[model samples]
Target: MSPLQKIGAFGAALAVSFGAAYGVGALVGPFDSGSKSEAKQSAHQGAGHQEADAESETEGAASPVVPAGLQVTEGGYSLDLATTALVADRAGEVRFTVRGKDGAPVTSYRVEHEKELHLIVASRDLTEYRHLHPTRAADGTWSAPVTLEEAGSYRVFADFTPAGAAKNLTLGSDLTVTGAYAARQAPEPVREVTVDGYTVRLDGELVAGKGSELGFTVSRAGRPVALEPYLGANGHLVALRTGDLAYLHVHPHDDKAGATKVAFTADVPSTGSYRLFLDFKADGKVRTAAFTAGTDQHAHG
Candidate 1:
C-alpha cells in the first residue's frame, strides 16, 4: 500500500476512536491555528467524562494535527498572486494579495512571529526554497523581491492570520518560472548536513499521525555553536512532504540564547519522505540547512 493509503487507514482508526463526538482533522492535516483549536475542542469533547481526563485535556495534551499548505484557498482566505509566472535566473519582484471571503483584498492582519505575512516559495522538486517577508501595501497587495535560481514549477505559500481571527491560516499557490527546466532528484535521507561552514545534525523520528520532537544542533570545527534568535526563536523549520509538498512552518519550543540545540514539535500527516529546511541566525548572518528524511522506516509496508 502507498504511504497515503496507510495514512488513510490511520485516519479511519482516528475516526473510530473519536466517533460521534468530533472529527478527524481530515485525511491530511490542515495547517492552520484554527485546525489546532478544533482538535482541542475534540479532545475536550472526549468519551471519558472523568474530571481527571477533562483536566488532562485542559492541560494541553491536544495532539498537533498534520499541517495544511496544499491549497490556495482555505478558511475564506485566498492567496491571489498578481502574476503566476516569473523569469528564471533573473532578479524580480513577486506580488500577491490575500482576498477575503467577500471577494475583496484584505488589508488588516495580525502579526505572528514578528511578521504580518510569511511567504515561502519552493521548487516543485523541493531542491530550492525561500522564506521571505513581503511588504504589504495600503491596498492589501504584498510585494517581495525574489530570484528563483532555476526554471521550474514552484509553490508559493502565504501564511498569515487576519485581524481578529481566532486561528492562523496557510494557503498555497502555484508559480511557473519560464525557461529550460531540468529536475533534480530529491536528496536521500541524512541526519547531518553542512551549510556555510556550519554543520547541523538532526535527531528525531517521524511517525505517521504522531507528534514527535525534532532537535537540531549546530557546530563549527567540532565545537558547539551558540545560535542567535531568528523569527522569535533560536531557529525556524520548514518541512515539506516530498511528493505533494505539503508544508509545515514550525517554530522551536525553546529559544534560550547561546543554546546550540533547537527543538520543534512536528506532526506530519502521512508516512512518506520529507524535506526539512532549517534557517538559523549565527554570527549575525542567517543560513539555511536542508535535510531529506522519511518517516519511521518500519511504518512503510
Candidate 2:
C-alpha cells in the first residue's frame, strides 16, 4: 500500500478502537441515561422524607447549570499541570496532561473543531490572550512553547472531548508569572478596535443567560475589507469574562465568505465585564482585534 494510504488506515483503526470502547452504553443509551441520572439524583435527595425533597426538586429544576472552565477537575477529568509557575522573560515550555478517572493520562480523544485539544491562556486583567494547541506524545504528555512578557496571574484552560465522554469539557487552572506586576484596568467599554491596520467595530450588548446578538464589520484604509473564512467560519470570537476569565467560544452564524460583516450569538453565563477577541483573515493573513465589553447588568449607573 502507498504510505499515505497506510497512514489513513492507521488513523481509521485508531478512531474505531476509541469509539468502540466508549460506545458501551450504546445498548441502553447510557450517555442519555447519564443526564437523566444526574437530574434524578439531584431531585431524589434520598428516601427518608418527601417534604424537603419535593421542595428541593423545584429549586433544582430552576437553577442554571454550572458553567464550564471554572474548575480544574470535573466529571472525572483533571487538568494536570507539570509546572504552575513560569519565568516571564523568555520563551518557555509549558507541559501538562489530561488524566482520566483511571488516574492515568488520556491517550484517546475525539477531535473537535479540527483539533484533538485546545489550550487557552489569558492574563487576569484581560490584556493578553493566546489560543494554542500543544503536541501530545505517546505518553500523553502535551507541551507547547509559551511566552509571557508581563508578570501577573494568568488562567490556563484545557478544552477537549475524551474518547468516552459525550460532551466537550473545559477545565481551567491558575498560572503564576514571577516578577513585579501591575495590572491594566479593563479598557472602557468600546464597540471598535484596531489591530494590524484593520479596523473592526462591534455591535450589540451581552445579556446574561441568553444568547446575545453580536455583529462585527471590518474595514481598512478607509474602505471595507473583504473577509476570508478562517476556521471554517467567516470569523472566530473568543470572549473571556473579566474576573474569572470564564471562556466562551463563539462562532459566526453567517457562513458567506468575502463579506465584511459577521454575526454571532453568545450566551454569556453571567452579567459582567468581558474582553472579546475577534480573529479575521484578510489579505492572506489573520489579525485579531480586541475590545473591552460590558453586559446589560453594567449598563445602568
Which is the leading candidate under lDDT? 1
RMSD of each: 11.0, 15.5
TM-score for model 1? 0.77
Q: What lDDT tens digits, residue by residue, belong to model 2 across residues 132-203?
A: 678899999998788877789988988777875645567789999888888577656555666777778777
Clashes of each: 3, 0
- How well does each candidate superpose onto the true structure, as a TM-score? 0.77, 0.75
For each candidate, the alpha-carbon lDDT, in order, equals 0.64, 0.60
Q: Show the colliding residue pairs in model 2.
A: none
What is candidate 1's lDDT per residue for 112-207, written digit by digit as tens?
A: 556777788889888888878888889999998888878999999887768877456677889999988986867655667777788888776656
Instruction: After superposing candidate 2 on the true structure, give the runs of residues whose Cα lies further than 4 Å from its correct spot.
Output: 1-64, 298-301
Q: Give candidate 1's error at residue 260 in angstroms.
A: 0.6
Which 10 consecutive positions of candidate 1 have the poorest summed lDDT? 15-24
